[model samples]
Target: MAELTTSWLGMRLESPLVVAASPLSHDAEAIGAAVAAGAGAVVLYSLFEEDLTEELAAPRPSGAGLDPYLRQIEMLRQQVAVPVVASLNGTTPGGWTKYARSLEAAGASALELNLYEVAASPEHSGAELEFRQVDVVSAVVSAVEVPVTVKISPFYSSVPAFVRRLEEVGARGVTVFNRFYQPDISLDTLQVDRRVAPSTPAELPLRLHALALLSPFAKLSLGCSGGVHSGRDAAKAILCGAHVVQLASVLLERGPGYVGVMREELSGWLDSKKMVSCEGVRGKLGFGFTADAHAWERLNYTRTLHAGLPPGGGRPAGG
Candidate 1:
């Protein structure tokens, strides 16, 4: 059998399939099921700063506030042998250090700082926003002993430079992209409906492009998220140099046991390829490793557009 073991955020994972921060890991039973189903690691649902602030503003409820999140972390650590990564979703540097320290004390194996922020303020430049994010990461890193990884948004003007800044500030890893929830307009009511949409396999190419671009130069461990559904999808992530692949929608849609199915299929593919481990295929198709490094850039875009046109170099018959 091919070795499936890989490392992420300075911790050794038994497999590349990690459960992303989601409601599926809200309880010990669910976490146990995920571990039983072959998840290498589990990232608990995020503790949002806004939620924490709101809870704090309310009158005391006998230690029921942040205790739930902390309790979940402790319970998950006790329930599964794999690493239990605690996720903190916040934009600022102020209050995060406290919770990060608490999570470390709760026995979290590592921490994923989910920097899911939108720069809606005209006062802040892109550079200012990026620096603020880096400061937040630095504060959390200073507060926690456990490894810290940042789950970054894809809207950054320069991903590579930002990733380098993150690494310099002591982030052990960076998850490629964070899914931003967009609101839809209800045509009849003329109101905005905030709904969370599940990711599809089609989303993989975006993550693949980011991974391929950063894997060569990034010193931090690279993880791919957003549209990981099957064994093939996970394999593609590894090939593009992702140290690990995070899954949420698939597990929630198919149940935890599907992770085992993905594991088996991935192993089968690796065995057939005569590869010893995931590392063997890691970065095999990344920017620096590819014959045409420019393929991931604008050249590939132009080629794709030209290739799609008819032989006569005009639009198709439907046009």
Candidate 2:
């Protein structure tokens, strides 16, 4: 029989299909359904510091308090058979520490620190801005005993260095990127619309580069998020060196039952290749084992030389 189970951050999972933090994990019922639908693990909707502050700044009955969120997560973990991770995002060190510990105590198998802050302060330099994340990771790591994974944004001077700092600060895992919701312009009123959408398959190339950069670290479990659509995508991500594959936008669009589709596609691919388990095919094509690793890094420099007016413009002469 083909072995589908694997371990993520030391947590035993039935598959690599992790339900990335989304509204799909906001409540116990949703999580229970996901687990039933064959999710390897689940991440709760990120408890955003800014959103919580706004919620607490003024009392609102429509909002669920922190305790309720924790309780719901605890209830979720009990109802499911896979590892349940609670996600915490914050702007302040104290908030990260407090909430990380709270979630850990609430029966969360692990914690994901979404350390993303828009660097809008003019007084903050790049180094100074990143220092805040280092401090926050240190504080949160010290506060909780569970495995801590930091999901960071790609906006940085050096991604490899940033991931290294996170690992040095006791982070057990590093998720290279998170798909953030980009605002859209409404042509009618000329206003900003804040609805977040799911990612598509076109994003694989970018994620492949990130996985290549971080794979050499070896110790930290690297997870790739954004644009994972099928089992083929999952296999490609693993080949690129992602230990755990995070899925969200796709699940949101196709429903939790999508896990079965991914499983079918992945298993069929393995059968065609005569591979039995995910481990047999995992990281097989990674930079760790690749011959020409330049293909991932030489992207920008090579693209610059392609003499052409991209897409809607004129094609360049070669002959």
Candidate 3:
């Protein structure tokens, strides 16, 4: 078997496959199963800023406060031999950042700061929003001893530049994208409805594009999230310079045991290609590796347009 070991956020992972932050981490047993099935690391479901703020305003029920979250971190450290990463989801820096220290003290190997905010206000400039996010990350990084990795959204105008700022503020790594759940308009009830849908293979390209762009210049370790469904997909991500392949949807659908299956597929693909290790294929397809990545992208765009149009040009088969 080709060596699957990968170094991510300064930690040596037995494999590049990491279980992403999701409800799967809510169950200690489920997390144990994932680690047993070959997960290199596990990111616990987010401890939202709103939850912390609300608890401060008015204490929630007994089991629904910061104490339980901290306890969960401690418990997971004892149960899983792999790195246990704690997730904190918020946009602004405030007292909530203090919890990052607590999380580190609770034995979290690292922290994933999920900066999930919609830039909905025209009043706020992109620069201003980006600055605020950087501040938040700086605060948390300064507060914790554990390595901090930011989970960013794909909506940023200049992803590479924004990531540069994060790196300056002591971020050890970055996950390419965070999935923002969209709201649906309800015709019958005349209200906005919330829906959650799992990501598919189609979503992988966006992550790959970002990974290719960032992997070359970024000093921080890169993680690919969203749309990784199979071993082939995982191979594509690593080829684009991702240090780790973070998965949640497929595991949720197929159960944690699927982790072993994906690992086998990745190993099989590497063996077939005669690659000896994950590092052997990393960044071979990234922007920096190409002669002219911008020109290549433009050429692909033109080719796609030319091949997509039918003779009449009404619509293509899939269109």
Candidate 4:
């Protein structure tokens, strides 16, 4: 049988499939099932800075605010032998990051900084936004003893350069491409209807593209998130050099048992390819691994525009 083990953020993972931060992790029963089904780790639903700030500002009873999150981390560590990663979602760096120390003390194996924000201000240059995020990572990494990984969006002007900054700031790993939830307008009510849609298989390519570009040269462990749903998807991610594959939507739709299925599928793929282990095939198709680097970059765009030419090799009738 092909070995399914992989290392991520300096932790040994029995499987590359990780339970992404979502409501699924809110319930201990769900997380237990996932680990039983071969999930390598679980990232608890994020504790937002706004919520932390509000709870800290107002008077509340002990064990009422961030206490539950800390307890959850402690509870999972006791229940499962796998790593329990705590997630902190915020846009800015502040005293709120002090909670990271509490989380670490609570026995969190690692910390994933979910850097979520919409850079809608024209006054703020891309450089400014990027620097702010780097600062946040630095603050958290400095505060925690455990490894810190960054979950970032793909909107940066240069993803690799931004990741380099993160590496310089001491982030242990980087998860590619956080999904930005957009609100829809309700035509009848003439108001914004906030709805978070589940990720589809279509979203996988965007992650693959980004991973292929970064996997070869980045010293930080790369994690692929946002669109993985099958064994093939997981394999594709690993092939592009992802040290781990994070999935939330598929688990939500199919339940935690799906982790075992995806793991089996990855193992079967490795066997068919005559590969001995998951790590053996890692980055086999990444930009650096490929013979033509430009093909994975600009050439891909040109081919996509000319995917299916006319019979006479000219533009279609409409054009």
Candidate 5:
């Protein structure tokens, strides 16, 4: 039997499949079911900074505003033996330290900071934006004792450098690519409307590329999120050097019990390959392990384009 145990953010997990931050975790029963179904850990739905500010500004009864969110984390901690990771989504640097401390007090094993900021302003330079992000991470890390990880965006000018800065500020892990929902314009109202869409398998390659590129230089734990719907997808992520695979859409679509199915499939693949554990196969096909380091750059790009072309360089039979 292949061992599926893996470590992320200094916590040991029974498997690589993590319950990503989502509404499914809002219920205690659902959390227990996911753990029973083989989820290694559960990341509670995010507490947005905007929501926090609004609540705090109104000055409700003591602990009235934040009590519900904090109570959910406490309930999850008591219901399952696996680690419970708390998520905080914010764009600015202020007001996170206090929340981080509260989460740690609520028995959260780790914290995931979802820096879902869109650089829309003309005055904010990339360097200024990057510095603000790092400052927020540093403040939160200093405020909490538990392991801290950041859910990063793929829009960074230099991902590797930013990852290094995260490590410098004491982040223990980095989850690749937070999905930014693009808004659509409504023709009738002539106003922008929010649109939400689930990830498809096609998004896996982008996560894989980011993981492979950073695995060689980053010492922090790497998590692959987005488009992981099956064991095969998780396997590919592991091969690309992801310490854990985060799932949200698949669980919402198939229910929590599907985690067990994915676990069985992943275990079977490992057994057939004679791999002892997930750690053994991690980074096996990453940039550092591959024979052609530049294969991920443009080598495969040119090869794939030419592979479909004819000898005469004209249209093929289908065309």
Candidate 6:
């Protein structure tokens, strides 16, 4: 009943509930289910650029490539009235542009570049790696007429600078921090293993950090998406300056119908707050709004060592 409709990356979304790039959105059936469940738009499973290269031939099952995904994407656009976004994660700039066009032809309303790379090479400096990231985003933006968004990892040293670079390269928006797998040890076999799952709710500080950095830049629309659980969580993201909030973990827990429940909860909260739209509350609680905002400075951690009730409260690390 409230004015929940909004524009994201220049596309009109009836609501702000976007189904994040996940297995659930890989097929027409799931996409339709998401629409029925009240998703504003569906971001197709991230198609890997490596899936198109020789690297894919190296034994392991490759990320399902675009070939098998076209039919699903087409059907989703036809069967659902909401925008259907195409997501791509590629290594080369060439494939990014080519695939962006192919996805557009397949009926995607917009594009999300999950621009990923792990620069483990000692030969390349961090500076070079950052430049390559900018080049990749620029190439994709130049190749696509559809509104473009990029999903970023939290591993960068200068997140704000990285986001500003994406904006300069013509990205319409940025999603704060994609949850990549971290490798841990398998004690039994003494092997490395990656835990593949959504982030826990405790992992919210990173999003808040991103929100603080990107919210002030009017040209950048931020999507704070790391550990959102409920309507209050969603509301908090928007309040801290995210333009949209993407969900993966909560939906995985409660199923697609959770979308409607969260939407309803968000609407009710807005009504209670005497707000008609998300835009009105957006960024109202950001650092700029607080008087003693400087406490957010990371250096405060080292300086604020108060003696506490706990035994080792004021002691040094590992004391």
The best candidate by TM-score is 3
Task: For model 4, give the 10-residue run with minimal summed lDDT.
Answer: 56-65
C-alpha positional error of residue 20 in candidate 1 after TM-score superposition, expressed in Å:
0.1
lDDT of each: 0.88, 0.80, 0.91, 0.89, 0.89, 0.79
Off by over 4 Å in 4: 57-64, 290-296, 309-319
CA displacement after TM-score superposition, residue 287 of candidate 1 (Å): 0.4
Cα RMSD of predicted structure 3: 2.7
What digit string (tens of lDDT, one per residue) describes model 2 on residues 222-254?
A: 888888989899888877778778888888888
Measured by TM-score, how close is model 3 to the native structure? Answer: 0.93
The per-residue C-alpha lDDT of model 2 at residue 42 equals 92
Clashing pairs in 5: none
TM-score of each: 0.93, 0.89, 0.93, 0.92, 0.91, 0.87
For model 5, residues 61-119, the per-residue Cα lDDT tens digits are 64334678899888888889999999988655566887888888988999999998789
Q: For all candidates, what are the clash counts? A: 0, 0, 0, 0, 0, 0
Summing lDDT over every window of 10 consecutive residues in candidate 3, give the lowest-scoring window.
Answer: 90-99
Q: Residue 215's C-alpha lDDT in candidate 1?
A: 83
Candidate maximizing lDDT: 3
- Give the better candidate number (5 or 6) by TM-score: 5
lDDT of 5 at 5: 95
Deviation in Å, model 6, residue 101 alpha carbon: 1.6
For candidate 5, the 10 contiguous residues with the lowest summed lDDT are 56-65
The alpha-carbon deviation from the true structure for residue 298 of candidate 1, after best TM-score superposition, in angstroms, is: 2.6
Regions more than 4 Å wrong, model 1: 59-64, 290-296, 309-319
Give the per-residue lDDT digits (tens) of candidate 6, residues 110-131. 8888867787789998789999
Better of 3 and 5 by lDDT: 3
Instruction: Give residue 59's error in model 1 in angstroms.
Output: 4.5
Q: Among all windows of ten consecutive residues in candidate 6, which has the lowest summed lDDT?
A: 300-309
lDDT of 1: 0.88
For residue 139, what is the lDDT in candidate 6? Answer: 88
- For model 1 the local lDDT of residue 203 reads 88
